[model samples]
Target: MKKVAPPQCLQNAFEENGLTQIDVFEFPEGTHTAVDAAKAIGCNVSDIGKSLVFVTETLNPILIVMNGADQVDMNKAANLLGLPIRKAEATEVRETTGYVIGGVPPFGHAKPVETLIDKKLLEKDTVWLAAGTPKTVFSLSTRDLRDVTGIETGVDVSA
Candidate 1:
């Protein structure tokens, strides 16, 4: 059987964002959820960077990159963005981010999405994130991730 390749969108992102040093990986054991990804990568669940999508009342998409062990506090997220927001539906998540739920990368979005990182993620030197596919992932230093995303300071978005 041929090995699965990481999505081209993820490749495009590497070139676009100066991430040539990072390598995308495919773990066939199903890294569709935080627990699954952690087990596959042999890392702590808190080291998994889960990219989540939310929709504001005005229909804008927001990407929150947080640790797998944490949950986004809706009230804090709303306050941080200065708007009311709710979880985006699967269709909306796909339509807005050009990726499906459970596969959304922190970067490489189809459109520019307002992004916030959970401060806890910064505590670790490196974290693993989805790479445009549920079974694909890539690791990045917390510092490089901040530089790439242009969000140097993380927020306490976790519950």
Candidate 2:
């Protein structure tokens, strides 16, 4: 199979972040869902890092990177963030992240939105995440993920 290149947005982000080791894979079958990405990558669903966007009560955008096996506990997340939160509308998501809902990547946003990663994802040595497109994904160690994205250890925002 010919290796398809990652989207320019992802490529620029990876290069700018010095994530030279990251390699993006094309999933023609589609990786729009965690289950599909897990099956394609031959990993547990929990190892797929799902990126979700939310709007705070202040109308600010925030990104949550959680394990595929878990769901965000909005109340807990709100408490942790010290603000009420709700899912971002499609327009808000695209405006904030420069990507659509099913294909939002962890980094390379149009703007630098506040980000929180689920602690559960840190338990794994490696994890997979969307790469600027529904049909592309990339693998990285949990440590490298945090480093590249400038995220701290993580938060217990998953239920």
Candidate 3:
């Protein structure tokens, strides 16, 4: 088996902030999808945090942290964000977030981005989330996650 390390920029993000070094676990089986992540981590799907990138009509990127078991209701999300949004293209995801689709973390980004966490995830004490790669993950407290993203409240954007 080969070892896969997360991007240096990602590691630096935690280090530079003086936060605990997030223990990233690698799964040869892959943790790209939320269901797959939950299976690999031995947790319920709802306990998995899925970070998604949505592009607003204005071409701005918003990172939405969602529960694995729920899907974003586009209409509700748009109403909450005050703009129409669509899933970002793969290229757009990488360019705006410095990450590929299956591994977009809730907070670290190439640039500062507005972020929102779903109320469902906020209800969990801890959840496993992708660690900047499709095959890696880490566990963090929901409170810490909220603090890191600077989103004090969660939104009801799930369908």
Candidate 4:
């Protein structure tokens, strides 16, 4: 079997932002959630950064990079952004981020979405994220993630 390489757009974004080496991994089928991803990658669940997209009341897309082991506090997120929160539909996610639920990267979206990085991720040396597919993931440092993704580091959203 052959491995599918990551998209050039994401690679370019990483390079343009001076990111370190990006490690891509291929797992078995149905490994979409973070727990499954952690098992596949042999890492702690908290090391898996889940890239979530939410639709604000203004119909704008907001990107939230959170710890896999943590829960997103929608109320806090809504309060911080001063916008009503609605679960972003799958179609909205694809339309805005150009990636599906399990494979949304912090960067390389169709447009620049307002990004928020979980403060907890800062404590980790590296984190794993989906590489445009449910069966694939990539590893990079927390600082590199923020730099490459242009994500603002914050603690607005809590578990």
Q: What tens-digit string does per-residue lDDT give for candidate 1 at 120-156?
A: 9988899999988788888899988888899888999
Candidate 2 TM-score to native: 0.95
All models: lDDT?
0.88, 0.88, 0.86, 0.81
Candidate 2 yields a Cα-based lDDT of: 0.88
Stretches of model 3 off by over 4 angstroms after superposition: 1-4
Clashing pairs in 2: none
Residue-by-residue lDDT tens digits, candidate 2, 1-159: 125677787789889988876778887888888998998888899999999999999999999999999999999999998999999999999999998887899998888889999988988899999988888888888888888887768889987
lDDT of 3 at 80: 97
For model 3 the local lDDT of residue 46 reads: 99
lDDT of 4 at 152: 48
**Model 3: per-residue lDDT, tens digit, 3-77?**
455677777766765656578888989999999998888889999999999999999998889999999999999
Candidate 4: the clashing residue pairs are none
Backbone clashes for every candidate come to 0, 0, 0, 0
Q: Model 2, which residues run further than 4 Å from truth?
A: none
Tens digits of lDDT, candidate 4, 75-122: 999988898988799999989988888888878787779888888876
Candidate rank order under lDDT: 2, 1, 3, 4
